[model samples]
Target: MKNKIPNKIHIIGSVGSGKTTLARELSSMLNVPFYELDNVVWKRHEGHEDIRRTEKEREEYLNTLISSNTWIVEGVHNEEWVSNSFLNAELIIFLDINYSVRTYRIIRRFLLQKLRLEKSNYNPTLKIFFKMFKWNRYFEEVGKPNFFKKFGDYDDKLLVVTNKKELENYFT
Candidate 1:
């Protein structure tokens, strides 16, 4: 097995796949800083897709975080930023829960957010939920295999966790 005491970890998954939740958990378990990619990519805005900032700014932010010797970065934009962010990661956990469970969680998360009027930098809407699900499907059908192949070429440290129980055991 690769080093369990990873200085850096990247969690990549489709929407509602529990990437952020798992990231938070791992960060606490590992005593490392954690960052949510969506918060970095999108500023707070209403009725807007929120313009993406320049790549340089993003890189700068990531550099600052990764320089800390330990961090858990989670997001769906693996295709765009995984290599740069995860190249040095001692572990990469890809959450691959069932579609039904993910959909349920997405809906529940949306309702909770709306009811609580949560002050999220990026709000979750029904449209975004469906789009995310579609993206998740695409990833399952195409993204995961391709990512594994590509990531394998770079590093041998990877763990594909399908459920929370499995993840807990692996981490333990």
Candidate 2:
């Protein structure tokens, strides 16, 4: 790793792509706070019932996070409202891990969550588990391409990671 790491970083990936995992590692290594985009979109509550934030609220909340000096923001969202994160970030990581790899993770995660071995923000219901698969496919077919189209201009800072080892290499 270099003496100086990016102060503001944004990470985007499909479900089970390890976005949150990377963010947490970086946050711990850099001693910075990290926020997940899922929490930004949904206000979590007890008993696994979450409320979706309004467009205006989501934007405002995101803005507040990006306004910080040093942070790692990770999520699967890439849209107009999230443009500011890209603009403000010193590093943007696109986790393009293999589709099959992510699928395996989804299954593993759901089983762990169901067994209470893993802590998840939402309930590990059958419906949500199926949706994870659907979301992963959607990301592969639509989200990944859309992200490249939308954020390609940030190539100077963008790090397209196809494998986790590449991330370690980046830091070392």
Candidate 3:
């Protein structure tokens, strides 16, 4: 059977897993709008400090996005607040990239952001840079296994991808 592209896709992974990049590509290929889960959690204003959204507001915002006809949501968050996205998605892509690759990406991304070669929602400071490593490791140990345990019920439609090439087959 020919693979059919999904209208509502949920992409999840640790930091530097290329969730944003893949989401953007898929959004273009699928002709759908994409949103970052981080955006839902924080209110961003260019050249100003970002404000964290209230829990209720974040839920409401996320709900609005999921309620749309078509969307691609990518994020590193794996919590009760985001469980609805998993339930609502037509396809769930868990990016299980190599730890070493993620580590390299984390460093590269921070450098790009610092050099202003790339734009960031938040200021790239030394503190956040350190936290990215911590978060990446946490996701590997606690977050990775927790995802399977919690969201494994959706395995029928879930696609665990370790490499970006794997996605090309599905999209093409």
The runs of at least 3 residues in candidate 2 whose Cα sits more than 4 Å from the true structure, single-residue gaps closed, are 1-3
- Two-way lDDT contest, 1 vs 2, winner: 2
Clashing pairs in 3: none
Model-by-model lDDT, in order? 0.76, 0.93, 0.94
Can you give the TM-score per candidate against the true fold? 0.83, 0.97, 0.97
Highest-TM-score candidate: 3
Candidate 2 TM-score, true structure as reference: 0.97
Candidate 1 per-residue lDDT, tens place, 49-167, comes to: 68776777776777677777778888877655546777777788888788888778777777878787544556667787678678878877887787877775645777878888888
Model 1 C-alpha RMSD to native:
2.9
Per-residue alpha-carbon lDDT of model 3 for 32-101, expressed as tens digits? Answer: 9999999999999888888999988998899999999999999998898999999999999999999999
Query: After TM-score superposition, what is the CA distance of residue 18 in candidate 2 from its true location, in Å?
Result: 0.6
Candidate 3's C-alpha runs over 4 A off are none
Q: Model 2, range 1-172, lDDT digits (tens) per residue?
A: 3634899999999999999999999999999999999999999998757999998999999999999899999999998999999999999999999999999999999999989999999988999999999999999999999998988999999999999788888887
> What's the CA RMSD of model 3 in angstroms?
0.9
lDDT of 1: 0.76
